[model samples]
Target: MAAISEALTLSAGALEVVLAPAIGGSVGAMRWHGIDLMRRLSDDDRDAGNVLGVAMFPMVPYANRIAGNEFDFEGRRWQVLPNNPPERFNVHGSGWKQSWTVARSNAGAATLALEVTGGAEPYSYRAEQAFAVSEKGLSVTMTLTNTGPVAMPFGFGLHPWFDRDRDVTLQFSARRFHLEEPEGVSGDPITLPPELDFAKGGSLPGGWRNNDYGGWTGEAIIRYPSRGAGLRIVADPVFKHLMLYADPTKPCFCLEPQTNASGAFNRGRWNDPDEGVIVLAPGASAAGAVSFAPFALTFPAA
Candidate 1:
């Protein structure tokens, strides 16, 4: 059927992004100058329904892992079965593993939606991802609505893996960093150290880093000198955390703009203001956007 097999494409100027609503509502590909900016998704991978092969995926209802896949909220216990097996926790919520419906699509834009009813859980919600392309690059807007009868904690984020170039550099500002626990869940908050700071904009850390940066200024810069272009990433204020995952030995890196620090559902309920967690009442909704705008870079031959 068309709904199960077709991939939607959106383009503006030289920027293009593809969406596959059938599998996790992810961006299948993103390209500039016919060169991949975001990692490309292959047809084989798509047919196999592999989320890892996609350029990017949306994290919704919640983001990141929940320790032990169980947490207590408002005197009731919520348990989530591990969706990504061999993994002890419930990672990246339920949206990415479920198919989404395309609400609308055009040459330069598309909107996809996923609905989840808590049923036995406590997070009935509706999540939407809207993509728009322009000469400025790509704009992704994520929205979540609490569709259940009770209020619940929720978060929204875009998980984009960018291709790495030898000269690629990153820059962003955050007030603090959340340490990671042995299980990859957020542990405690600490001030940003110079070695981990990108305030001045620099290459990805030479070592592995998988932590959440709090108090993000909602902006980031990524440059690829070999390509003679760079991107200016801007986000809505609601996105208060910038999560960077870099492994020097890897061929890609990720800089995620999200609404709340990971594990906020359990340990951070009391730390609302600073952690950026959103507790929405029934029928209430929240939305934010992230943009990637490209600019040219020039270098003279020696």
Candidate 2:
């Protein structure tokens, strides 16, 4: 809950890195242009009030709703807790809202770990979160190892909010996409929904927008024309297969790269062939990495 320990101002480029060690492990805070790029979740602050990014995991599906919250996996019924209020469903991952321990810290990076045991029915996992800031950009890697004897289902993803405006363009290579019903309404996929279309590049006209897309090639590019700044997010091809876009009537938008659909654990639809069902044997481990590379486009000084 508390930032037990931290290290800062190291010779690691112009970026300012802060490491906080707590009971769970460690949480690394990276600052760029006075903007907290990642979501800061602590005992006091549980949301990304200032930052624009957060790595999501352990399992990010509607385990508490939609697909019925009951999955017949391997001949067993698993019941997950409902974490979402309005929709009354489970969204994102568990550890994200929980406090993490600060294990180690240096000027460059810090590692945070969280342990969850004996959760609703079949959702127990021990996870480690590592955040690093370098001259290139920010990198977050999470490793979840099943300590339980039984095989449990899980997934991993990241929620990073970016500045969205007329000058910002989001580009990524994908052959297909999935559009979700507004307000978590369950239904058939709307092929190439206007908001879900990013093939030829476009801009956010305005209003609230939230949906999921799949079939990505493991790369995302966000360009800021006015500031001449751009961020390239890359993920392990074997880790992420779906991308969620959410623009909630703000100057920012989220490009979430996920391992499976929001309800894949139960629905069993639209799962990435390359990345699906994260199963870990007792003492076995599954690790995935997400990286953000920032570049300042240079031109002749006016």
Candidate 3:
């Protein structure tokens, strides 16, 4: 179970971040000036160590699903068991379900590390998350190193859940949208539709929306007019894909920044630049960072 007593807290100015390293390296909560920037975990969930209830979590080795729980790489076929049940496939890899050790930490920063060799997934790698909070905002740098004996395809991403305020607005730029098949599988890419295109900023849809945005600009803005504040997401170039997930029946939504597409492994687009897959040889590493900066929202002559 996840114990809040073991969680670490970091604060700077009006921002505060609580990290539950042992709880799948997830963020228990994030607040700015006492306003929840992300979905805050409840005490019951915290005590239960429920990752799904946390504010955010890390997706290592890869993100999203691996169709049929199998794939081929380097002339070798590999298979992963169904990690998330009732889904019929492996989703989000194993990082979010494993415990992480705190390599180092201080008042304003912390680094949590995990090593997986002979895990459920046919990949062996070491992952680290370095989180730092400053007066400006919070920044998380994710690093993944292949620790196996051979080359392999790898990817990493961050999954953050945000509160779905009635007046919240989102904006970002992407070249194409990966269509969604049944059971949340990612299909082929298609031109962005008028409603799905957010280059000009807009409100969340009233229905279900779970899709990946390829060729992302690596930046996004989410505004909460009710709180008079907004957050700007700046990601590194390595993260070329952005995923938006919003269910009207839920009280929260997700904006994920990842290195590869939702089903790049299954799509067989390993070397496709637009798919954002990284073929890393043994001992090679890939790293990137994402920053969240909050700013005051300005209304016109309100």
| Candidate 2 C-alpha lDDT tens digits along 1-302 | 33543322322575655543331232334455654443333434323321213222323321112345456767767665555555455566465555566666566766677777765646567777677778877677877777777766667666655555567777776655544555563333445555556666666546555655656778877777776666778988755454545554555566777665554665553334532556666777777788877777677979
TM-score of 1: 0.95
Q: TM-score for model 2? A: 0.78
Give the TM-score of each candidate.
0.95, 0.78, 0.97
Instruction: For residue 171, give model 1's deviation from the true position in Å.
Output: 0.8
Total clashes for model 1 = 0
Query: Model 2 lDDT vs. the true structure?
Result: 0.57
Clashing residue pairs for model 1: none
Model 1 off-target regions past 4 Å? Answer: 1-4, 300-302
Model 2 regions more than 4 Å off: 1-11, 17-30, 33-66, 185-195, 205-207, 269-275, 299-302
The TM-score that candidate 3 achieves is 0.97
Candidates ranked by lDDT: 3, 1, 2
lDDT over C-alpha atoms for residue 35 of model 3: 89
Error of 1 at 5 (Å): 2.8
lDDT of 1 by residue, 25-75 (tens): 999998887767777888899889899778899998888888988877677
lDDT of each: 0.85, 0.57, 0.91
